[model samples]
Target: MLDIQSLRRDLAGVAERLASRGFMLDKAEFSRLEIERKLLQTHTQTLQAQRNSSSKQIGAAKARGEDVSAIMAEIAGLGDALTAAETALQALQTELDALLMGIPNLPHESVAVGLSEDDNREISRVGLPRVFDFPVRDHVDLGEKFGLDFETASKIAGARFSLLRGDLARLHRALAQFMLDTHIVNHAYTEVYVPYLVNAESMRGTGQLPKFEDDLFHVPRKDMEKLYLIPTAEVPLTNIVREQIVPREQLPLKFVAHTPCFRSEAGAYGRDTRGMIRQHQFDKVELVQLVEPKDSYATLEALTAHAEAILQALQLPYRKMALCTRDLGFSAAKTYDLEVWLPAQNTYREISSCSNFEAFQTRRMLARFRGENGKPELLHSVNGSGLAVGRTLVAILENHQQADGSVVIPEVLRPYMGGLSALRPATD
Candidate 1:
């Protein structure tokens, strides 16, 4: 949520920034609502003062032993008017809140001013895409020879699902474990276990609700409250401090979680439909940091590097790109996407997105820290897919495939895969 004070002070400036991101702010509507809210609040305050003054008058009349019936009747009439004014004021406030909640976060000044992914600036590329001696196969074809079973997965759960067996399944699990261990040990992030199903308030705190409902999977309970499936572990990990006020000593809180993520893919139709690249369900090792505002930008760089470290450890070729203003996520002030090379596609695909949300998420979550001045202030949030497990799996399969339909496991993941070095096909 934007600071209402900023909007009140300069709605035009805020709206203009929003326009750069292709979001048209309803200026006329906002102005109208603001005017009405101010009027209603003023009217309510006046009525409240009037009611208090009338009660005092009635008290004096009773104290003087004079007939107080007339005064009592006047106070009753004032009570009715005050109640109506207060109710109207409350309703208008709710409307204003809803409007504010839907607005995306303003991009940071450093973000490039552009309208799409094409305008995103490349920061740097690490490791070159290997030249394959044989015709490259995508993850699907490479995994099928070993353990990737799509037909069975589809039969059980419909499209955009896959079942891996033997080494392939172990490799997938190993990827997640490797990421979690690296983040916890090397990155100084506390590993947490969170619920996969969260309440609507949790979703709202993380900027996932009231806008992207269609893209979420929700369960309606008998009590009528809906629990939403997490689209990423970032939601749960970052929200750990929701509605909390941390002591200054805990200025920087980093957390990591390895969890299964589910997305409805409501808007993603017919894209990457052939492989695990766009699965409905996938595993991820998420990284989240809550830091004092002063340290947030530096933390974002460190956080992005931590994710890049995973790709480097796996020896995967990847590049970092700074997302343009319009290409930034709804809650992010700035974002960096790490696109890993895919040998089959002969191009890079996004494996992780690191973002500095500034105080956008903290404002909504009411997550704050007491500062040196003894006042509570919002904490800035940073998070990223330390590496999307499925996509990393895809990168490994496609980039490490051998001519005999075998996939060589990365050296770091071998420890988690029972010291096995590669995945090979089974002979009948």
Candidate 2:
């Protein structure tokens, strides 16, 4: 959510930045509704004040042992009007909130003002792609040889699902465990276990609900219609401080959670149809941070580097892209996407996405910190895929495959996998 004051103060400027992301703010309509809301609010308060004053007069008259019936009648007359005004005022406020929630965050000044991923600037490419001796097979082809079955997974659970057997399945688990440990131990992030399911309000806090429902798996509940199934741990982890006021000393709060990320992939039906790149459910070790607004940008760089360290340790080749404004998500003021090289696909694909949401999410979550000055202020939020487990596995399979049909495990994963160097085809 955006700061309503900023929207009211510089609506046009905010709209222009959002335009790059294909979100257009209805400035005139918002302004008109806001004006109506203000007028109704003021009128309601005035009527309330009048009612209070009349009540005091009635008390005074009764104390004097004089007739208070006429004053009582006047107060009764004000009741109907007061009720109507109060109802209208509440309705206007609700409308304003809905409008504000739909608006995307304004891009930071440092964010590139471009329209799409293709226009994103490449900040750096770390590690070099390993040279291959033979024709490289994609993860899908390689998995088929090693009992990574998609056909059975699809028949059982529908498309974009995979079932790994023996070493491959265990390797995936090892990857997530390693990633989570690295972020928590070496990077100063506190490990957390968050809810796999969250309410709609939780989704909205992370900028996923009101507009992007199609991309989520919503579980129905009785009474309130609250949704469930978290798309990422970012939802639950960052919302921990929702409606909280932490001390300034706790300004930079870092959290990492290894959880199963669920996505409906509604609009992504035809894309990445093969392999685990696009799935309804996948393992992800996510990183989240809550910090003072002043430290957000610097924190973004540090956070991105923290994610990069995983790739470095694993010796995976990856590149960082400074996402263009148009490429930024609804909740992010600025974003960096870490794309890892996939030898089979012969291209770099997103393995991680780190973003600085500034105070966009903090406002919605009501996450604030008590400043040194002792005033409550919205804290900035940042989250990233420490790395996507399935994709990292895909990159590993394709990049490290030998001509002999064995997959060489990355050196860093050796200890986690009980020092096994390679995965060979298992005999029935």
Q: Which candidate has the highest TM-score of all? A: 2
Kindly list the per-residue Cα lDDT of model 1 for residues 96-181, writing each as its tens digit.
99999999999999999997899999999999899878888888888888789999999999999989998888899999999999
Clashes of 1: 0
Worst 10 residues of 1 by lDDT: 71-80
TM-score between candidate 1 and the true structure: 0.96
Cα lDDT for residue 308, model 1?
99
TM-scores of the models, in the given order?
A: 0.96, 0.97
Residue 264 in candidate 2, Cα distance off native in Å: 0.7
| Deviation of model 1 at 148, angstroms | 1.0
Per-candidate clash tally: 0, 0
lDDT of 2 by residue, 233-295 (tens): 999999999999988887689999999889998987699887889999898999999999889
lDDT, residue 122, model 2: 98
What CA RMSD would you report for each candidate? 1.8, 1.5
